[model samples]
Target: MTPFVIVAPAGAGRVRLLRTGDDGLPFTGPDGSGLFGAAAAVTVEGSDLARTVAVLEQAHPRWVWDDTSRWYPSLLAAGVRVERCVDLRLSHAILRHSTLTQDSELAMSLPGVFTSVAQVGVPAPASAASIHTPAPHSTLFDDLDDLDELAPSSSAGFGATDPRHSDRIPRVNGTGGTGDTDGPELDAVTDETPELAGRDHSTEDPEPDTLEIAEFRRQRDAIRTATDPSRIALLVAAESAGSLVAAEMQHAGLPWSAALHDDLLTRLLGPRPPAPGIRPARLEELLASIRTLLDDPTVNPDSPAELVKSLRRAGLNVSSTRSWELKNVDHPAIPPLLEYKKLARLLTANGWNWVDTWVREGRFHPNYIPGGVVTGRWASEGGGALQLPKQVRSAVVADPGWKLVVADAAQLEPRILAALAGDRAMAAAGRDRDLYDGIVASGAVDTRAHAKVGMLGAMYGGTTGESGRMLPRLARAYPAAIKFVEDAARVGEAGAVVTTRLGRTSPRPSDAWQDVQDEAGADNATEAARSRARSAARSWGRFTRNFVVQGTAAEWALCWISAIRRRLWLLDASTLAPTARGGAAPTAPTTPTAPATDLRLEQRPHLAFFLHDEVMVHTPAHLAEAVAEELRDAAREAGRLIFGDAPVQFPVTVAIVDSYDQAK
Candidate 1:
């Protein structure tokens, strides 16, 4: 296959193209000037962009670009898609931070041009929400969604197996963080720098092309010499493919019903506020009811401090305004308070303001930040895509002739744990069955709830409450599974790093963490100091404990998405609409090969949304079943590729729905 490199907007509305070979060194022809070892330099402008891409597709050359977010959207808009690409920015982040590449000079250097993409790779710390909702009397529930209640928290060190946390730390190195917008992060270069025979690749600064090509070459070499080249190659390819999916999904945009969303908001929040910074009628009524129950009209429920004081005055004896805390209180005020909190969340998080900003031209185009979480789960920039409230899910409606096929892997993290540990008991429990149910059958716990809690505790270092109580039972039932995480925890407690299956390494403890450890060992350390040290150690242990399983699970998700994208393209596109209706559960295929599916990979039947283990594909209504089957097949393919003959199965629960609410 011919290898191609594309540089976007090489001035004058033209895109620069270069073709290379298997060696990856620039192509050099007999009469070539060899400015950058190019056999030829061609600029294709105007409508020829798509034509050029279409012609290049025939050769099937691997596209090389700085970032997919910047380049692929335009191609996708112009009705062109490529099979393979080399994402220099994404690969740079992986190679730069990878322990496997640490010995190399390029890897040993500080943050460079290539290092700007680190935010997309590493998970942010827990601090505050990047975008805070202005909810009055907001509780912990305000930040969580239905998924949070049903699944583990996605943040490292959190009391959950699949930790996905984000705390915005002010970044100083120009641009990067979980919140960084999608674009070409590389500096523009009009020409290539002179090739230096003895140049230090680790230098602080270099020309954009020089740094880009050097880092790309270094990463390629690192993977070639990797401990497991095949796995590393799979990982980089999957990661880069993820980049493509992210951009393409954004370009396609999630089909949203602005009218329906407006209706939902009006019914719930009592219409839009008459003016900016004003509460809607429904919210105001809830607030009034809350104050009446407290008998303090002067009290402000939005102010946590004022509300807590008011509740104490009302003789409620509540500790805080959080729903969970108030749930324990039997006061009549609790009900209204809960109602107020719920509506407040809806109005603030996904209300009219959100609709105006996010939903554009009947589509919600969320900016996907691939590899954003520390554990490798993706994040979003704007539109609160990750925090899709169930109340507003009704607005995620399919177009008139299309349907949304939503699929989520059943008990994904636990199954991932089973595969990672190669635990026969765990795998046997999870294979082709509900893992928690299988655990209950094994006599590990008395109930499904206990089984779930025990496994979560095992992976996330949950040694308190019901989770803590069930750990011993889990250990006895699945020794290998429990020991896998236990060993990782032990390593973390010793301040050692752990690597995911595909080699994404967890960061080491911070300097403060090390100081705490050292102080605990010093003779001058007080009991409080030792206590603090132990607490921090346990915290770090929780992170590493879940890191391997969570990170590996992320790898499985990437592979799953990549496979689905490829599979969606292979299906035959039909102009005829299938028999299934758009707004309900799609009908089963009448024949082995359903006729006139109207699912076109080049146009429709594309992925619209993904969150952790769940994916929503927007496809022609007729082809919903086919897309669902393809999703299932891709999941199986991802499992086989990632774990080979491992007994564990990644079970996907798929639904063909007209709106996202129907999927649930």
Candidate 2:
């Protein structure tokens, strides 16, 4: 029979086939070139056919077209194995070998490997053939136990391959006879495997260590348990009236203009509509069904099977597979529940019945959350009603005779870029002015629009290859900004998870990733394909780098909230007065005719709404100016709190408007 030779790329270094010939030859030469050179002359031994076929099947071509680190473990789980993996580490290396040669087989076989590996479990081997072995021939299985130990920790650092391992290979001498002897040298490689071993892969860094995580889990558990009774009540109520409200809303075309608070009150007080009169009865049935479902202690709350069973009992034709599909529809209980949620939010914002007590003179207070978006943005809850639509800003009337004052940050993210990149060119453009104008001044691109697209693409990891060719020029113009992204990409590719400022770590890569990386070799097209996938994975890491910045911005917003709250308390009672429309006056005096009463800052300015990089505060008409000043100071303090006083300026745009839209 014809001998089947496994020919690896020239730069693959030392190729080791899993199966050996009768003479025990893993490869004809170190680079596998001799195998191809004698391709037509060699003949296979019939006795070794099964083993040879098995080895070929197991070592089917794999591609690390991108980064292979992340998919390594999944490849293992899927039962796909790679005999050779390649790590062409540099783009120049890829371009250099683009021409056809004896090494060209590696490129020719790549497409097939990608297709086969993707279809079946097997992946092509990666090329790291440059690493010297202990002997003339080494079967991979001989080193399995020791290689397992080295695989986990070996991939750390900036380079794609393990620098330490790459360095040690060429220095070692073979334990077996010299390569000139024509028999199997497998034992020599096997003997050296143990010598090369370092740390145990299984025992490396155990997780679940942080105290804060433990505390968070404890708090989460407590909240879950404490809310159980309320949950049950909500469930029962939702099951009962939910369908009727949904049906009514669907039929009546419930006007969106109606205040949620009013609609909820009406539902609670009015009679049931005729079309869905049986909805109340249906709720009881659903609750009974839930009880029956839970009676089975083995049923898991999170299980789709259990949920499907409960739904079936409630007369819904649902199954585990169909549960996701059912959620999009307007279930009967949905409208009423949504209405309740809206009312609840309104009551929470207005201080519930305590509105009369909490509203000092005629003003309500609110709270603000910064760094809330995980992207350096702010949010508001309760009286921070700035979240409301612009059309409803009229609802936030000033005190008897005062105006509403609002302020927000503009082009916040770009300024963040300037600070982070420390790009003198970009900073100079933003100096004492707008960021877009600075890009316009650079002349790297024709207009701010092109510059904007390029800058955004660089930050977000868009426009690679041709579409991104302009990036290098941009980077040259603003080297600091380019370096910031480059460093972030490097950190991401290395598998070091990035996190937000408040300790929100990016999720760790899964096992599949390790398997893919384990398969990458300098000569293996399969490994090359896997490498491509790994590069894609780093995109999320890049996003997280920006997330830290965005999230910090959110923290700053909260600080501003706290600051504005402080100044609002200093306002006198005369500043607050009820208007004829049941609203407060537009502007009034800071002091009233009556004696002064001491008030806490906490009791004054209320947070009404929050949007990314912006905040809205509600204060008495007389204290609008005070609140505006407080807003400015808070913004400055927030900047100082995050980036420190490195001469970074965060200017806020303030406005006193009667409507929310006008403020924006």
Candidate 3:
């Protein structure tokens, strides 16, 4: 049989077999519209290339050439004597002479590239032929030499059941070993507890395989250390400054306060603390401090001397000495002082007076309240919890025998923006992988860097006019997505609070706001100001539109959390042991499980840290992979539940690593 070649344009409706020319190669299709424009050609090489070509000719109707080497492997596996050949022109020169010289580079790169191309452009029909002849090799991956660098070794099998084997499950490091200083003995504590089921519980503890364990320890320790009463005090002070600013704005008849405070306390303190006794003089002092902070560029951390000098350009006279006084003063210095008092009182009631006595077994489990901010976000409690200080992350060390699993979502908000907007162009941009890259490809913007800045500004209510202007352009380019935000904004302007798919409601507008709007009709300067206040009120309403998307995103986060928690509980005790061969080393167990050790859903993996759309968990090393899988599955399920698997798609990026910082 003469060797032949098959070629198909990317979006072509059919595949065709062409007679090999004198050069013994297929001709490149003409460059134009239709299949020729959409796709390239396919090339096959091997001992029996002619047989492989015959098989392809038989299956021509269903075949598509997404790339040059798409079907080479599958044909070879089906008893056809063909192999994928790498076109030297396309191969990296440096890699061509390296350890990969003998491998079929075309076989390696084709699948990923083809899968990507197929998703865009157009869909092709599946082959209708019923050729079922099995190849001499039982496995499709018979050409192990071609993918030796990519494949797992005998000692690194992924689903090995032996306690001494590393490949019992998918591990971040490929080796089952968790690079934790503490050994696998911690599996016992995790295994015996029903709450920690779905976790690997092998008796043979493994040593650290990667820096992931150390990173996790660092993050865990950081969380533990930050929870110290003093640290919490500092955070509360900063957070209170934000709150006090809102309150002062409210008192001064500014409408922003209601929006800023919107259900924040209810989410944080749980039903809100009883209205505190308001000392008019004390409240006045706190308000003044906040005003000073907002007005004075010198007092703000991001302010530069030049910027401070420029504050007058914006029509504000703030003194440097006033900024210094606010920072230097302790008890009497405005909002921080009042916040400290309130936080101190709460700590006392919780029996956390002394820092040493407050922590439980060197672990501090902070409460992560979802939708805590009116913007549909999360807030933390207990330790310097919600907005963690970077300096303190080092304190989140691992427990004596355990490790931490840090995972996060990448480009979450922008992806959410794509879903909400239903902009096919934007959605198509994201379909290929990176959102920023997609934007660049669209040619709607100049560069990926600018696209990033514009998208972020649009979501956060970009103050600079540049972002606002660019946003309309983006909306014009992708009407569906832009309309999503516009519709939400319209609802918010009508004074309606948006709700999540799961029924979590946005805080209702305060009655004071209603009064202000009602009084705007009166003929007075106050009424004119009221009209301006109403305009300002629209910002929060805008926030609510974003809040719905953001809050629902939070719900997805919790779903991932719940899934990981459950999967960890299902792992058997024996599966977590160190592999006997080139396997993960075993670490010594540090914390012994007591008879009363009870793992609750809330306690299984300590949620030590959270930022916007990501979370960090500290668990026994044996349960790390299970936790990672659960996180991914849960996120997907949550998306389906919230958006219904329809016009919108929600995808999550999750990675399990030993260290908290490494996860980032």
Candidate 4:
């Protein structure tokens, strides 16, 4: 078994696998001798790809590939799960933008396909505009119409909704989408094979095997030469592992009860409207009450501009229809208006249409985009997996013979701040209790509320009101932690960059931001211009201050989940069998495609859902306690990995429940 196996598309319906030596680099050794050995490489037919990979996986070699999403799903569908992978695409994104690696050729080079895929939604800084081309405007089809609720009239007029289309076929990990053209091919070679990120590389000098190998080696060199090589390397590994977890979670899908969803919707929103462009019965009733109270029967509640006009006409001192602002107004229509908005949100965001579109085969298979957010948090592509409102959470049910083991880190970001800053005082305060309460116990503030507000203000640049007043005391008690963020904020104000604990750097302010500062310094500049510059600087400062903490917290989360993944793999398979504890026989749920073995996912506990700090595992009933322990152990391991032996504790609140809402 080799240390590394490079998987590259050989052609349509076929792939080439190159085995690397202990150095994880094929055909490269210190003495300039080829390291590919006797079995250099093999071209496997698409039909044999899964079996070949499964065989190789037994050795526990780290697999290297262009993109995890493009390859892992097919393997999972074929009942093949690899333990570890080096996702070049995800790693490229982190290394290319990291301050520690900025001097490396990979980071200094102009943006290309790799950059486009890694930084899909990232806006190009002014200095790089000429060299970087933005990718197509990608959006989540799941929440595509949520924006329409408030879009201007010309954009999507009253009652306008997303174009009606057939339900999206379930393609775990976006494997069947346009961007997934390079996914598994089980037939003969097609005329052409798409390159990374769905681009054609026919005109390039080297074949995909050469290109992939080259890019990977470039990344490796960059990381090796990085200022903080050790931390950067760990960050890269954790991030790539996150990609695998994201793909697998999507493949397993969140256990969903469509029937329960419909019941909840019907109770809250009335029966689904009989036809398109019609409101649910309850929503229509709320709308009627709102119109009559405001003496505008025709006013459209969905239109923000019109709703405000009606409210003003009805003698309510209101500037907008926002729920928070409406709550402050003393008016007869306010109650009904707020109720209408709540119901309207549910109807549009997760109504019958959402249930029909996202849920299939008793599961909600969302497209998870790992490292999509600049802070290293994940973003979903199609389904609104991140925003599973408590209103609809009850519908996320575990299978009869299984259980949902949900655990979330308590006060994750603050604990991350404590660890990153090495503020022993702050770390001591949060030792084994709620962080806010710990702060209060340390005499940082009189109440838990003030402690929380003060800490949030310290991290988020909150310098006014209650948070502002508490900041002084907090700073006095924990100067190290406060100064850490204050330094980041100051650097950002001066248009500098701040790096997270693991080397993820913050993007510089845009050209417009620099121009404002320049204008403020000119002889002809007005006080207004100077004020604008100050405001911009502070805004960006606030961003950078939180960036360091939030970004590092995301890193901690990645490490935590990665640990959980590895630990779960090591659990005894016998314990995961549903009938091991005399639980009812399991039922096989329908999948998009017939898998080689239907029970592969159920063979052990697997992560079914993950948000910023919370995770849910779908496991056999018999293994619930074991899985919960694994989650706890993973949290502790993640802390040790990122902030070695830091006195900071990352506590996880665990719940074993039959459904998601119950966990909460």
- Best candidate according to TM-score: 4
Candidate 3 per-residue C-alpha lDDT over 542-647 given as tens digits, one digit per residue, 9 for 90 to 100 = 7755764675465455444433433444444333332221133224332423221222222244344556666565555566666666656655554443333323
Model 2 agreement with the true structure over 1-664: per-residue lDDT tens digits: 1121222221223211222221112223233322222111122233332332233332222121111222222333332322222221211122112111112222233332222221222112111101111111221111111111121112211111221112111111122211112433322222123322331121212132222222222222221222121211111111112112112112211112123333442343332224432233333334344445435333222346765665555565654524245655345632432343333344444322333333333333333332223232433445443355343344444433434566778567656655554456766766666666667777776676667767777767766753286677688787866666566555556554443222222333445754554555335657566766576557555664455345434434444543443334334554544323234543545444333332211224444444555656655555777778877876765554334433446778988765445666
lDDT of each: 0.68, 0.38, 0.38, 0.72
Instruction: Output the number of the lDDT-best candidate.
Output: 4
lDDT tens string, model 1, 553-601?
9988998888788777665554333333233323333332344322323
TM-scores for all candidates: the values are 0.81, 0.42, 0.44, 0.83
The 10-residue segment of model 1 with minimum total lDDT is 127-136
- Better by TM-score, candidate 4 or 3: 4
Stretches of candidate 3 off by over 4 Å are 1-360, 368-371, 374-376, 522-530, 576-612, 646-658
Worst 10 residues of 2 by lDDT: 125-134
Models, CA RMSD each = 12.5, 28.4, 26.8, 13.6
lDDT of 4 at 58: 48
Per-residue error (Å), model 2, residue 332: 34
Summed backbone clashes in each candidate are: 9, 105, 49, 0
* Two-way TM-score contest, 1 vs 3, winner: 1
Ranking by TM-score: 4, 1, 3, 2
